[model samples]
Target chain A: MYTRILVSALFAGACAGLIAGILQLYFVQPVLLHAELYETGALSHFGAVPISAHPELPGFDLMRDGLSLIFTMLIYTGYGLILLALMSLAEDRGAVISGRSGILWGIAGFVAFHLAPGFSLPPEVPGVAAADVTVRQIWWFATVGCAAAAMWLIAFGANWMVWGLAAILLLAPHVIGAPEPEVFAGPVPTEIAALFAARAFGVGLAAWVLLGCFAGYFWQREGVYADATQSA
Target chain B: MTTMTNTRSGLRILPALFALALGGAVIALTGHVQAAALHDAAHDVRHATGFPCH
Candidate 1:
């Protein structure tokens, strides 16, 4: 039973991690490259590089980057934990796939993220073009928030307190707005937003811990004796 | 008479109360209106399948 749980979680985590990595490579990376090209004409030559135009690995850079890795791990961890949690429910009832419960949880989480804002780390150098900021900043937060919340509520519960608290803890700084310090004496518009994304992803890491515990409970199975069948 | 009394007693309010609580919870949790992203995604997904949610 324990081995099954571990195997299921590892499989789920690896798959989720790979998918997340691919998304970063194919979608997010190109967008970043485009933003850089729009900002500094000098960087346009670098942007012409096919590698920059297309990200071949999604979550690899995310894993390597100190901040991005945190989010990638959160996604991977969440998937594994969720799988475990559903497995536990089946163990309690019987050793079978509770397809209904599993799909319900998955859909719920997916929907929550869809409704919430997207999130991502901001670039170090501020860009001159408004398009770059607007596209990356607003869209990313909205999309990520929606996606994260959907996943969270399903994996956790519909308890508004849990949902709202998770959202606030993860996204408050960005969603509520952050105060930018002027020690650098520079206007960095995406700094606060990026902070919020980073913080929210951190909260997601904590949530994944809950996922692991719940998964363990759900996947725990009781031994069945052959003689027990006589009672039925 | 005893069986009728027992049957009446067995039909308790707990299940009804539990159902009410669950329903209330579902409403409370989902009541907070969200942005259009989910709806948009659903729309897109549905359109691709030629079965629009609209």
Candidate 2:
């Protein structure tokens, strides 16, 4: 059983992470590279040459982009491990797990991991002013934890009080508020920042959906094989 | 039957715990680590995937 769970998570995570990394490379990385230019003062928003609507971005560097791809896979695989663990727990509780249901799981994952925290602390560009990293990280982790708990309650809770608690869990973090920098200032244009945030969310949604589907599929397959081996 | 189910569930718990711990550690390393080299290596991804970063 342990090996089955581990193998399922590893395969699912690797597959989903590869696709997510590629999606990031294509849709998200260019915006980041562009933001870096403004951050370094190479392309200033208010400079002599106003930034063009579609300025030429730096071409990909193999080293930088390659590292990003590998890291993305690692991060998503970590997410996969956590997700599969939860799914396994759910299955033991008599929940049916499958690729179809996994889409909903994926959406829930996105909401918990990305949307909930981002509601207050939107993704930022390279040069953007922000709160201290440690403070922000604490808030981010808290929000994700609360949101994940809330999602589980919403899905499996049997009564109104449980639902009520879920609502509180969802709202508590935002009400307390995310850490913020006293002054909002940065070299990157707000337009660029906005674009970056939107694309980040978009890629996140796609990757998570894929991750859920893959996780669910592999998990089911592993269960079948485990049973077959037992019978054999 | 009840004892069999209990034993099976008990077997399941250890792996689930292990997965959660390992997964959480990997995410912390990639997304939350504070070292400069780690930050630079994960910079673009940190931004792209929406992990909070400098």
Candidate 3:
């Protein structure tokens, strides 16, 4: 049984890493590459190769740079491990298939963003100055607001009622207060910072998964092995 | 699921292993999506819970 649990976790961890790596490469990376900060020089210092300049696959404009690699590794190494933990905890075969609970916790992670104080917007493009304090703050708030709504739907439920309510709530503030770009002299590389931050979060999330997997694997294994020996 | 294809010691552990792997992949792919927002949400929840992981 101990071996069983260990094997389970290892298997899960490997799959999580592969799929997460692919998803990041295909979907998330593109969205991030288009961010304002990536266009700016903010992320250039991370490595010699610029992500925006990288050659993308046919029909896929996604660019892979240090920043994208950071995000991919963050998901593959960290978040992938966490999923292993979750699988160990579920125990039952059906639990693995029923991913509703896992998704809720995922949303909970997103909703937590509303609690942040603020963030500074980096320069827009290469050779531009950073965004002004007000612009940064507003951007932070707006982003947080949108995230809050999205997370609420995720954490609570993605049902029509929940989604509808979240949609209304999301649109309310936007109608009254649209986030306008702040007047800044240099290009605001805020998007670059956002990309980095997102990748960092992925790393942290992966850590959480790994920790859970290890704990659950050992905990279950110890109990099962003891029981098996006793029965024998 | 390939884990189940090869049996050792008459134990059907491979299927469970594959299932776990599949689940892990899903979670890894979906878990940290919209993560900045989640970070903020967690920040708020932590404060509300009075744990303060900062």
Candidate 4:
């Protein structure tokens, strides 16, 4: 069971991570690179004449971009391992696991990890004003935890009371509120920031759906093999 | 048969726990670590994935 879980997660994570990395490279990275120009004062949003017709956006560095790709794969693999473990537990409780249902699982993951926290702390671009990293990190972790528990309750809980509790869990972090900068300030333009957040969410949704599909497919395949071996 | 099933399920707990732990550590390293060098290394991704960065 352990080997099966590990193998499935690895394959699912790698495949999803590869695609997610490429998507980010194509759809998201340009926005980020443009924002960095503003951040570094290479281009200024405020009252400064334009630097040049075409400010040289940093071209591809193999090392930096390559590492980013690898790191993305590793991060998703980790997500996969955790997700698969939970799915195994659910399966033990007789919940059906499959590619069709995996999309739902992936969406739940995005909600817990991204949307829930983001409601309080929208994705930031370079030069954006922000709270201290440590405090924000704590809040982010708490939000993810609460949101995940709430999702689990919603999925498995039997009664309204349980569902009500789930609702509270989902709301608690927002009620507490996310940490904020003393004043909202940044060189990055609102348009860029908005685009960044939107693109990030879009990429995240696509990646997670793919991850869920792969995980479910691999898990079901492994289960079939296990059954065959047991019967044999 | 019931006892066998119970034993098998019971043995599953350790691996499940292990998977959770391992997965969590990787996430923390990639998404949550505060070390400057690591942060610099993962800077672009940290921002791209919306993991909160400086």
Q: What are the per-model numbers of colliding residue pairs?
A: 33, 0, 34, 0
Error of 1 at A91 (Å): 7.2
Could you tell which candidate, 2 or 3, scores higher by lDDT?
2
Question: lDDT values of the candidates?
Answer: 0.38, 0.89, 0.41, 0.88
Fraction of true interface contacts that also occur in model 2: 0.83
- Native-vs-model 2 lDDT? 0.89
Q: Please report how far candidate 4 places residue A183 from its true position, in Å.
A: 1.9
Q: Write the per-residue lDDT of candidate 4 for residues B1-54, one digit (tens) a residue.
A: 999879978887777888999998998999879898889888888888888776
The reply for model 2, stretches above 4 Å from the true place, is none
Give me candidate 3's interface root-mean-square deviation: 13.2
| lDDT tens digits by residue: candidate 4, A1-232 | 8988899999999999999999988888888898888888777865656444345677778988898889889988988998898888888888899988888999998898889998998877878999999899889989989998999999999999999999999999999899999997788878888999999889988998988888888999998999999999
| Chain A TM-scores, candidates in order | 0.39, 0.97, 0.33, 0.95
Per-prediction DockQ comes to 0.03, 0.85, 0.04, 0.76
Best-fitting candidate, scored by TM-score: 2
Prediction 3 global C-alpha lDDT: 0.41
- Candidate 4: give the clashing pairs: none
Per-residue lDDT of candidate 3, residues A11-61 (tens digit): 444444444455444544443444434345444434765455443433443
Which is superior by TM-score, 2 or 4? 2
Question: Which ten contiguous residues of candidate 2 chain A have the minimum total lDDT?
Answer: A45-54
